[model samples]
Target: MLGRVNHIAIAVPILEEAAAIYRDTLGAKVSEPQSLPKHGVTVIFVELPNTKIELLEPLDDASPIAAFLERNPSGGIHHICYETPDILSAAEKLSAAGARILGDGKPKIGAHGKPVLFLHPKDFNGTLIELEEV
Candidate 1:
């Protein structure tokens, strides 16, 4: 049902600065910024040896990251993504187990162009969980 950790997403006020910090300060390989309108975020991935770190910025005022920034100001960890061999089955199992899925309870295209679904934070000890199809 669950695989390796996919990526850790961090919401930031500025995408470029966050990406630069990873690239220059941490000496990491960073990918180009991509706007995910459906998710209302512009993201850049810092490619690491074992996993990636996603830096996300709000695409608009209505973006969820914008709301997160309002509370955090400095921004913070947005979500942790985990790879899943079968998202639909995983969703079913999670649902049956009383875990609430966010949004319409359907998988959407993620940053890697894979099917992804988000679980509610309350169900996961205040941490938002993202399941991405492997």
Candidate 2:
């Protein structure tokens, strides 16, 4: 089962500009850019009091974020991550419940170096959902 909201991800055409909005304008504490080549994204985290905002930009044309940006030039919320006590069990439960998991249906190392799985957007009200093991 899902736990607390981990972070809210927003895809941006330009990571720097997007990060600036949160860091400069909003006066937030933003982390340095971290390139996740395996995930094909470069991310920056905006630290929040209760949660975090993840800024995602495509690492290359083949990146999923690139496709998302193509469809949404202005960029927007890409996904919402929720924590889980056990990802494998969570995946199995969601799978048995008929929710489709993305990719190979296996957990991958996320930005926080924690195991994570992505559920299909169609299964979650058109919003991509990421489950991260806590």
Candidate 3:
């Protein structure tokens, strides 16, 4: 049901600073910031040979990432995304297996403009899992 690891997301207090670290200090190719209003985050992707690293900053106080930042203050790993060949089928299988899906239990358009669904962290060893249809 899962393909390769898509991208690991890191919630940050400031998007520009985080992107700078990856771009300047690490010498990574960071993509331009993209605002995802539906997800309530502004993200920038650090390109790598194998996988990408997503830096997320809360779009507003109501954003889930804002809550995460409040808890950590310094920010931290938010979620890990995995590629799935068929998100609907994967969601159905996960649901039948008793894994809870976040939100309305439906896929949303992700950063890559692909269908994505988030599973409960409790069901995945305290790590939020994002399934993105590849």
Best TM-score among the predictions, by candidate number:
2
Task: Point out the worst 10-residue segment of candidate 3 by lDDT.
Answer: 104-113
RMSD of 1: 1.2
lDDT of 2 by residue, 28-54 (tens): 999999998988999999999999999
The candidate that wins on lDDT is 3
Write candidate 3's Cα lDDT for 12-92 as tens digits.
999999999999999999999999898799999999999999999999999999999999999999999999999999989
lDDT of 1: 0.92
Q: Positional deviation of 104 in candidate 1, in angstroms?
A: 2.3
The window of 10 residues in a row where model 2 has the poorest summed lDDT is 103-112
lDDT of 1 by residue, 1-134 (tens): 87999999999999999998998998999999999998799999998889989999999999988999999988899999999999999989999998999989888887678999999999999999999998
User: Higher lDDT: candidate 1 or 2?
Assistant: 2
List candidate 2 segments past 4 Å from native. none
lDDT of 3: 0.94
lDDT of each: 0.92, 0.93, 0.94
